[model samples]
Target chain A: MVNMLSIKNLHAGIEEKNILKGLDLTINPGEVHAIMGPNGAGKSTLGYVLSGRDGYEVTEGEATLNGQDLLDMEIEERAVAGLFLAFQYPVEIPGVSNMVFMKESVNAARIARGQEEYTAGEFLKLAKEACKQVQLPLDFLKRGVNEGFSGGEKKRNEIMQMILLQPSICFLDETDSGLDVDALKTVADGVNSQRSPERSFVVVTHYQRLLDYIKPDFVHILADGKIIKSGDASLALKIENEGYGFLGLNYVEEKA
Target chain B: MSQWLEDVIAHAEQPASNELAATWLAEQRNSSLKKLKEQKWPTRRTEAWANTSLVSVESRNAKPTPANITSWDKPAIPGLDSIDIYFVGGQLKTDLSTFTLPEGLSIYTLQDEKAEAVAASRFAQIKPERHIFGLINDAIANSGVVIDVAENAIIDTPIRLIHLANDGVENHSRVLVNVAKHAKVTIIEHGVGEEDSVNTSMSEFDVADNATLYHYRFALFTQKALHVGGCHFQVGASSYINSTIVAFGSDLSKLNIDVNYTGEHSNVDINAMYLLAEGEAFDLQSTIEHAVPNGTSNEKVHGIIGDRARANFGGRIHIHRDAQKTLAQLNNRNLLLSRRALINTKPELEIYADDVRCAHGATIAEIDDESLYYLLTRGIPRSQALIMLNFGFIQELINDIEIDPIRAWLTDMLSTRFKSMEVS
Candidate 1:
């Protein structure tokens, strides 16, 4: 079976320091992969580098989605090629409405894919349905994008975008960080609803609590810019039970 | 002295063909002529005109536009149903006999006998004396309008004053308005021109005690047209004035606005926007004075400079010693879309009252890369995302407009203008 995402020896950094040094990962179709790490483990850096964010330099490595060379495309081109990054701290665009923004993004992706663009009525229908699934009020569609949204609401908004765009592979960059128990379950349920044979997910988090709801098929421990260990769901249970000290490493909580 | 000044003086010295000026107007013109003679032409040393040039107004050939040429098209605001008054080439085109006057509302030409008292009271009264173009306008502007609203009257329909400039003509236009006590009215000053011409359009308003005035001024000119104008207002006790000013830069366009709060408990709010493209230039200066206690004034100015265009904004708020408990604020923000585009912004606050609250800020910025990246990650193309972001910046001010049709008209008009601008 073909891999949905493949990253080999990914050595990327921002400004002079290398954060993702010699990292490798593979994600198969329909599989859920949870990345667990302590502070400064390059988890978020991996997501940013894969999404082609500016200032993130891939010094030595190859990353591809399906058969396309993701590194060769522009940021929006990479997005059009079915790569999505759910920002940990979503940006607030005070004047651009959420509904209008999603419609533009959806039609932009569709135009690049040589597919038919969604009409206003059709897009409105889909947007309303997505808002319902996230349990957000429909009036949020008319409000500014992420403007004045609370932490949980921002995370849910990211999922709403995911539902509307329907990208092939998604990287949730600490999306569960600020969410409460109820919000985490709502977010996990949104992700679970989109799981299919043609879709894959990379969930990055600092805590093991979120793993209980999402139930990742595979778990990996990343430390010091590389993956140090890989196992099944039980590995997450072990880390939760015994912290990072069993691996002979100091467990420093990330500073805000 | 510049040759343009010499020629303008010569033109002002020549008597009008039918010189039957009223006693008050004649005295005002003579004083204005004396001031013009003593004032030196503005050079780079002039603080108020430091970043603007008068070459476009200087080099134009002077030609008097023919009388009553009403062939020009008038822009209509859909669903507004305003009472339109047209002035083409500094001449009134609307015939007074064509429509009946709404009750308690009166419109008259400056030369009409019925407008004598208003013209005498407000001809050159409120505008500052330092403006050379305004002085020239006072000396020779024979075409103007006077509008009066009676006490305790509420005018439903807006009064529109449309001025159109013709090629090679030196058009000097003027307007004076009086809103009586407890009355309410809306006025729109619409100016549009596209020619190798120069125009100075000045207007003044007196909002009386407990009255309300909603005002808008649109300066729509580009290419070879040149415009220098002023809008002045005097707020009475407990009165309110809400004004919006929009401009599209011409070869050289300069506008000055002055608002004075003469009575206590009066309030004034102003929002001004300028959009410049290509080699166009726009210079805007506004001053709000809180002269009495418990008066408040707020001014917000924003601009977009694209291509090789240039924009300048100067905002001043003054709280006098007697104006205790005054609240005044001024904010100016600009966006430069190209490396060659230029913006100069200066916001000033002068307060002599110890109990007053006054603050001013100015900022010039480029497109934010983080916001751009955020949009790109959502699959929107770079160009489309830019238009969205740029328009979003100005939409904040547009949303403040209370009139639905005018707001919608401006949204459509400005979006087209914004799209045509070159952003690097």
Candidate 2:
């Protein structure tokens, strides 16, 4: 059987310097993987490449989903192709309403899938239901998208879109970084409700605390542009207790 | 098109009448016509005409036929069917009109002999040096609808003037409005024509003491046409005048809206929107002369230019030396969808008085790419996403409209136009 997502010998960089060198990973549909690494290990660069962001050129290798090429699609096309990236720093757009943007986006996705667009009532119902699960107020949707929103609110709103789109492969990149305890729990609870046997997620972070709530089925240590170790949930606590220093030899050499 | 254009051009200068008018008025008009003949018709070479040069009427190579018929009846906008007079193609179409106006509200055509005082103060008082069309109007104007709202009489119903012309034709029409002291009224003038017609005309409005008026115009015509119109307003003391213009018709058009805020504590609000596509052009020239103290004025114009079309806005605010504590603002913004599209804007504020609040700003740019990507990531198609963002740019000013029908009609038409122009 084919792996749901495969990244093999993936090397990428930001201007003149290589960030992800000879990275390799593969995951099936029923897996939740956590990628923990030290500073400057290309964790964010990997996220940027996967999301089709500009300026992060993929130098070599394939990052594919379901045997289809991912790098060649437009950013929006990549989004419509069952992919989601919860930004580390969400973008704010004034004057564009949150509700109108979401409805238009949902309809766009539906139209691409050869389905009918949602009416005003149908969109309201879907958006309301999503807001309930995420614990966000409906009125927040009426204001401009992310204008003047708190840091925590911006992250929650990103997850709100994730829930609304229901992408098969969701990448929550540093979602819990700026969030407080309550916002984190609400966001985590929202994510937990979205898990399914046919869906998979890659949660990228520097710390392992988020794994306490997400409970990744697999933990992979990514350091120096490559995965050096793999283990179960306990590997996260091992990094939490030992600070990624005692994860073994490759990590020590990486530090040096 | 020229044949149809000549028919209208012939109407541009009303035949000089032989009737014995009071000497002062007749000489006023004669001298004004002489002034029209003295100066050449403004061309693309003049400062005011640099961006919106007036193309000659003879370019059509044919005379107007006076019979450019149409297939579509003007769609029914709320409160439009109740107008006092209905004119199409410079000819009154009485059968299409239905109304039972209040006691003091009535319409009179210029052909009627009752226009003695009106023909004097309005026609003779017009500034002949600014535009050539007004002079042509003075020389050839045959008739216009005159609405009179008496003092202490509040007209609950709006008076609408609908001007419709045919394809490949030049349409010259005129209208005069009189709002008496202490009276309240609203006037909506819409100029619509086929995509292939040419339209040019001027209108004069007067508001008396303690009177209030809401004046509006919509340029929803064909893209193959050219339209130029002018509006001159003399506002009285302690009165209010609000003007809103939506220019979307014609391939090339220029609109001149000026208000002489001559009254103390008088208020004026002017707002406009233009949507351009292809080789189409939208031009606006405005002047607000503050002749008295304690007057307030607000002006805002928004434009969205697509394809290779161009939009130019020229505005000037003039305050007299004695006019103190005046408040005025002018803002203009443009959205260019194509790299080749252009928007030329100039906002001028000339203050001769002290203790005034006046400011102006102009911007030309493409839609925000970050905003575009953000919306697209949410599943909104590229086209719908653009419409949503574009509407937000003008929503605040659109909300500034108090009359419900004008606002709704503008919104609906703009949405449809936006979708039709959707970038493929």
Candidate 3:
């Protein structure tokens, strides 16, 4: 069995501050990995570095997706290569309708992969089904992309895009942070419905509540730019009860 | 002063044998020529023309006579339905035009005795001395249109005016619109031409009490063309007026628009959008005066400049002491796509009334990188992402357009323009 995502000795930072120092992680196909850490443990930085976000410099790292060099690809090219990053804070793009944005994104990715493009009708059908699955109103398709959307709606929109793109490696960067109980379930169900033998997800969150909905096969405790410990799903339950104190790590709230 | 001013005065001194030109038109023309000669051409030293330079147009002589324009294909705006009035080389093409006036609406050329008389009587409403372009237009304009809408009448369709400029010709055009009390109408003016041409045009609108007018102007000249135009509006009591100007594709263009509220409780909304690329220059000066009490006005100007293109926006809102309870707002937003592109935006508010609400704002910024990155993360290429963001910035004003076909047509035109800029 091959690893869908592999990172070793990964070091990244923004500006002069180093966030991820010598971080190592592996996400095998069909496995859901949760990364829980104390505030400044570089959880989000790891996700951003993997997704090629600007300002997040990867000083020393080896990251691959399906054995391909992820560091060498452009931001959009990385997206085209079946890497999806559901942003914690999705951006608001006014005037570009959600339907148009989704169509262009899906078609661009497909064209980049040398696959057949989706017709308008076909794309509409697929988008409608995806919206239904995410429990979002169909009228949202006509509105601007994430413009004036509520917090929960934005999260659901991210999941909707994730489902539509059907990436091989998914990075859920705190998707459950601001969502309510119902929204969390809706997002979890959307992720579960798309789960396949060839799909993998790296779910990063501070709380273990999301793990109750989307069961993870492995739990990693990241601190000070590196993963210090790894265990099974039971380890997340232990952290939820005892917090990071049991691991002898001080928990300072990350100011972002 | 440059030779263009002398040529303009010489052209105005020539005599004509028309009955309409013998009365007030002749005196007004003489007075405007005197004013133009005394004032000379506006330069950077002038306060109003501080940010705009007319050096390029100072030396070019005006074409006194209308060019002999041959028969050409009738111009059409995709998805627009209107009563078409066509002009070629500053000459009205009555043969190629079609006008079917509905009840209480009349359209006539300035050559008609009755129309010229009507225009002459209303000539005092617009002060040509305020602008050099207006003065020149008033002195040499030979072809124009006069439209009158009767009281309580509402024209459902827009009246379209199309002007096609001839190569190396200096064209002067004028438009006079009179709307009676409780009447409503819409007018759309478009200019399209090829080659090097100089055009100076003026439009005066008289909106009566309780009447409404929607005026839209689109200046789509060629790269080598220079356009100078003016719009003067006198809004009456309780009337409503809305105006939008979209300017693009001119080597150097300047538009001066002024609105005066003569009656209480009138409302005016003015919006303008301009796109310039590849060494193009555009200047827009708009002034809204709340001369009477209980008037409301809003002005917005947006521009996108790219590739060393230059743009200027001067928005002025004036509230007189008698204009109490007036509510006025002015905003100018500009986006520069390249480091070389330059934009000068100024919002001026002169208020003497103690009990009025007046506010103004101006902003010039490049495209937001965070927004660009957000789009890029969605698998959209850099160029396509830029085009999307640029269009999105101007979509607010586009949404204000009530007509569906015109809105769709403008969206298509703007997207095409964005793509061309990206290519260059």
Candidate 4:
């Protein structure tokens, strides 16, 4: 059982503030890992660091996707190397249509992997199916990317991209934060449909409601930039029942 | 006076070889020349021309030459089926042109006796007090066109005006469009010039009551060429007028557009897009005036500048005291592709009417890094992402074009320009 994504002593920070302090995690293929944490626990920072976003410097750490160093690659390079981060707040681009953006993204990834590019007709066919799967109308493809979209729709749009790109490692950063029950279920179902033996997922959430639908194989409680506790699915249920207070964890800010 | 002003006056005085000028036209040209002699060319000292300089155009030393009508192939615009009219070296090429005017629509050269009367009347309406370029164009224009659409007539095909200039020559042309009451028409003015040539053109539109007019201008020239042009609109009661100007490729280009609502309930839409790269300079000065009540006007200008290019946009909207219920909006949005690229945009709204709704906004910005990163996270490279964002910025206005062929041609032109810029 090889680890699809491995992070060891991942000390990452934004500007001068250390957020991810000495974090360590290993996600194996076909496994869903949920990272639950209290407020300011660096849950979103972990996702940003993994996807190679700017402003997040990995001070001292090792992060790899299938043994390839992720921290050394450009943002687009990391994306082509099978790392996808579902942003908590998807950006609204006013002029680029969803269809055009998706086609370009898909083709760029394919070309990077030495695969043949999809023709317009072929891309349209695939995008239509993906839109249907996400319960988004086909007309959404013609509109600007996420422009004037509802919160639930944006979350679902992120899922649609993840499904289309089919990256080996997916990071969902607080995707369920503003979603209602129906939206949550839809997003969870979309994630479930993409679960495969060769794919891995890192679901970062502050609440345990999403974990109930996705059913992560491992649950890690992140506190103060590190995973302070690790357990099976029952840990989530326990945290939902007793809250982070019951764990008796003291969150001390780490100085760089 | 400067050498440029002297040369311009000399060029205007030596004209009239093509045909006998009508009495009204001769008077108009004489008055314009008198005004030109009294005033020098617009310089940086002028408020409207502060961001633009005429030094390059003045130094070109291009003189008005006799018409060198060469046998040339008809220019083709992809996806466009239009009545093509060609003017080469500032002279109308009737043998090379092809057009069959439908009933109720008439087209003629300014030299024709039938067109001279209408041209003279329209020429008299242009005020030469402020616009030096308009005065210069009227004083020395060697070739021009007059198009008239009869009352209640609707012409489906666009009337295309193609002006091609050769090097070391000054090409001055004019166009007069008269849309009768309850009529509809579209006109496309396309200009291309060789390196180091100078092009000065002016077009006037008379839109009558209950009439609609669509005017599109595409100016593409070499890097060494200079383009100076103007478009004026007189909109009547309940009439609708739409004009779009697309400027790409030139050393120095300046366009002055004026729209005046003469009757109540008249509406005007003025939109322009300029794409400049590598030593290019473009300046647009537009004014929309609402004289009567219930007038509406909208003006939008978008610019993309790259590689030391400079773009200037000045839009002014005026509502008179009696022009109550006037709704006017002016917006100028610019995107700078490189650090050295410069953009100067100003939107001015002067409303004397208490009940008018007039708003103006101007913004100059580079592509957002967050948006670029968002696209990069989806596997698109930085360069491609920039192109997408840049295109998207201009596409907002391009999408409003209802003509399929014209829209397609513009999209192709923009993409080609983008690709060329990427390589350089």
Candidate 1 lDDT tens digits, B229-294: 999999999999999999988888999999988889998999999899999999999988888899
State which candidate, 1 or 3, has the greater lDDT: 1
* Of candidates 3 and 1, the better by TM-score: 3
Q: What are the lDDT scores of the predictions, listed in order?
A: 0.87, 0.75, 0.84, 0.85
Residue B347 lDDT in candidate 1: 91
* Model 2 regions lying over 4 Å from their true place: A1-27, A37-81, A103-139, A180-183, A220-231, A234-256, B1-29, B55-80, B84-89, B95-100, B124-129, B194-196, B249-251, B403-405, B420-424
Ranking by lDDT: 1, 4, 3, 2
**On residues A153-226, what C-alpha lDDT tens digit does candidate 3 reach at each position?**
99999999999998898899999988899999999999999889889999999888899989999999999999
- Candidate 3 lDDT over B1-424, as tens digits, reads 8677777777777775223364566676777777777775667889878877677677777676778888655656687888888776778776423555789998877666666646777763564358887887777777778888989999999998877777787668888899999999999988766568888778899999999999998887658788888888999999999998899846768888999899999999988998888888888988888889999999888888888888988888889999999999998988888888889888999999999988899888787777777777778877788877776667678789988888888888877787677322
Q: lDDT by residue for model 2 over B115-228, one digit each (tens)?
A: 555655675364435776566555444335656788878987787777666655445566777788999888888787655665656777788889999888877655666677
Proportion of native contacts kept per candidate:
0.75, 0.52, 0.65, 0.90
Worst 10 residues of 2 chain B by lDDT: B12-21
- lDDT for A221 in candidate 1 is 91
Please report the candidate that would top TM-score against the real structure: 4
Candidate achieving higher DockQ, 1 or 2: 1
lDDT of model 1 at residue B271? 91
Q: Model 4: per-residue lDDT, tens digit, A114-195?
A: 9999999999999999999999988989999999999999999999999899999899999998999999999999999999
lDDT of 4 by residue, B1-424 (tens): 4566577778678655323465556777888888778876677888877988888776555476546868644657787888888777788776423555798899877766777656767773743258887888777776888898999999998989887777666678888899999999999998886467778888899999999999998888658778888888888999998888899756678888888888899888888898988888888988888889999988889888888888888888888999999999999988887888888888888889899888889888876878988999999987788889877767778888979878887887886786566422
Q: iRMS of candidate 1, one decimal? A: 0.7
User: Model 4 compared with the native: what TM-score?
Assistant: 0.85
